[model samples]
Target chain A: MTDISRDVDQQKYNQALEKFVSSVNGNTAFDGDFQGNIKPYQINQRMLALNVLRNNFPTVEKILGESVFTSLAQVYGKYYPSTWWDVNIFGDQFAEFLASQINSAKADAYNWALIAEIAQLEYAFIDRYYYPGHDSTPEVLIEFSHFDYEAQQLIKENHPNLVITYNCLDRFQSTANGEKFHSSHWSVDSSQKSKLKIFSASVFRQNFQVVSAFSCSTANL
Target chain B: MSSIDSFAGKQCSLGVEYMGAGLGLRFPHIYEILSQKPKINWLEIHICNFINGGLNQQLLYELSEHYPLSFHGVSLNLGGPEPIDVAYLQRLKQLTNELQPKLVSEHACFTSFDGRSYHDLLPVPYTQKSVEHFCRRIEQVQETIGRPILIENLSRYVQYSENEFSEAEFLSQLCQRTGCGLLLDLTNAYVNDKNLGISIDAFIDALPHQFIKEIHLAGFSTHDEWLIDTHSAEIPQEIWNLLELYLDRYHNVSVLIERDNNIPSFQELYNECCHAQSILDKYPS
Candidate 1:
């Protein structure tokens, strides 16, 4: 084929594919839409996206309930369309989407913050589960004591890849306290601040299992 | 030489294999497979699952040590209009070089078009134009990977009006043009037959028999009058019958039982493999 014919063919394919993508994304006005099953196909596409979201963010799904979760997932599907071939990576930006949604909602500020933290935690787990480190050495076996005190401190300061931490301790503790108070009383005052306890936890994959270690603020170095 | 040797020699001559029967390596059954060292002939794995370097990659390396592996991928959208994703192909090539799988395969359908990807196997119109475009992409992929890849048939819910060729005719012409092999998915064919009123026999008969290098057997579910290829449940009896009919003609093909969701115990999947083996055992290669 001549270069001119090749360009024409390429143009035709691009046009057809654009129509198909639009139709699949629920723009049913495209000429390439499935003859009689466009509506059903659209529904199936949404369900596929929702299923991926639920799988990736089980905690968020449970907290938001199915109805609300499905509504949010549909909106997310439309706003943040899948750009990768692997659906596993399709929900990479979902935590940010949840944060935006929570900010827009007219819910209790404390409860919504807790929900957003849960989304962050769940998305982190999903990302860690799939993209764990390439090193063959076990993370738990790494000895910080082997190096001198100054070297160890430098390593701890510079080596960001050594740990996966979610700095949501305050939110986690507050949510627990709020749930405890809500079990006995109908409502808890959002203005009342609980005792602040700062801590950190490192979640890592060891022996094909997710393991974590927590250190409280009072622990001696 | 033993019968197995003869079969292997013949298959190797064709640049493929007759890896008698196998099962998809699911994470749930990874421990059992690694520890027990089951008597299965080979294993098929979704290549995308192990693309990222992690515990999964380590496990895959170990599994390759025990059993011959075949890499099946879901992300290579060969039928799409855009130039195939070069980055994906590079990663795939890296994995292929590491595993040195007995066979590598992807679907004949497209999963992405333009900049957006559906993440599901979407059907391509079976027109002459589509066939040419799809074959050109397949040729490009083969050139990039430095090896021929098998293309599997998809179980589709809709067909385009502009389609000028049957699925089999398109596949046969594709193989003729690009020298690619076929991964005849019996469950997909059965589902498409029931859902679209296409004749399964005609579909199978349309393909060039020698190009069929692999076979996939899986289960489907019925949802709102549509037979969905969920690969969740056990291989139904009708699909088994279809397998028997397929084996009658093609004896030198690797068969794999795939279960992705609602996975059963390892014993149950092993029994399914044994059942497929019994059918393959019925006909001498």
Candidate 2:
């Protein structure tokens, strides 16, 4: 730790930093005309959050372009406006947001489902970027063994055009101690330029099996 | 002794050290910076971004090996009428211990209120009681981090009607009381000058030269009649002139160029640093 220096009155430095501030707020012993409006701060925050979200989900922004993306970003902010300073929690629901846009015929340039898929992929990569990698991945077709019945049901019921829950992410998400990342659906074989195998329920079953394999790595994209 | 009780004689302020002109290390510019290894004086980061361990943190450690680094934070909320989070400061302290940045800083303004983070620096009302308010928080931060911090004045939309002292006087008292230093952000001064009619030159003159440990030079955007310190565009000539005014007396203060929005290409930003570097080279220790 850097060297700390404190030489203020004890009567003033009342509580711990947070507790002290609260007491100060209550005491009202200090009188000043510091009337702060929260609106300007809110406006700036919306802009900052959008810029950061654009960085976090580049593919979504690039596909939607500036005008479309800004519109989507405003809508995204309205729904999930919690500060994205922590990158992990910022875009957790972005894919869902994109998918909802399609339902409303808002983004009709291309396949919105495909765009949602891209968002999911990008978010997973970002999550992977934060968690980092400790395991080495081979550049071959690898089997993922962590899928439960619901995951298999989603793939099997959706048929050939199903939203494949990129299983590689489930096996590799190593959450940090006490970090609050709730979603565990994105992983990358981060060691080398490795092939990311996306397994669908139609392709895999009770046993580890693959009927059709697709290279869905962000590298290929 | 109660944790709230001041750490008896545990305070130690770091001495003045300058590393020419520097740039805020943004995530988008990191990969290119790693590969290209551009010529730059130093790097300042938001501190919160790298506190959580990840590839960015790992890369930051690698970058620290090659450049002089400083930690600039936004969450301290030193001027807010709320409790400062102890856990946040401890995490910050952990990173400070691991990286050992030469200079560590937070704005003199509050960032978060109640539980919601405003996510932008709000102005602190300059009054005698608020001076004590600012001092106690700065002392708490200094006490927690075990280092004297440089308090940067913020850019805001409004000035208080009950401002007892000018920004310079308020900051001077805080420095005298708590042993803290000032990070004179010239662009913020320029904004407050234009928007609030406070004379920038007068503010600079009133501040003790010994207390100004660092200089922050950046660009601001115009909002109707007000000048917003948006750090988005290239460094304006007016802000550069302010740096000249500040550099006239204060030397060996580290200069940093900040860009938090509409960040341009690395070459463009790095070239802007050359401009500040040119000015720094004009003045010598």
What would the TM-score be for candidate 2 when compared with the true structure?
Answer: 0.70
lDDT of 1 by residue, A126-195 (tens): 5544563545433321111111222223223433233433334543477678644222111222332221
lDDT of 2 by residue, A1-221 (tens): 12232233322222222332232334332223333333355467567558757867766676678888898887777667554335444767888888887667665666677567666655544554354331212111223323222323323343332234443333334344344432322333544334333422223221222233332344433
What range of 10 consecutive residues in model 1 chain B has the weakest lDDT sum?
Answer: B4-13
Worst 10 residues of 2 chain A by lDDT: A133-142
Residue B228 displacement in candidate 1 (angstroms): 1.6
Top candidate when judged by DockQ against the true structure: 1
Compare the candidates by lDDT and give the number of the best one: 1
lDDT of each residue in B57-100, candidate 1, tens digit only? 76788889899999999988888877788887887788788878
- The true-versus-predicted C-alpha distance at residue B261 of model 2, in Å, is 2.9
Number of the predicted model whose TM-score against the real structure is largest:
1
The lDDT of model 1 is 0.72
Alpha-carbon shift of residue B17 in model 1 (angstroms) = 1.3
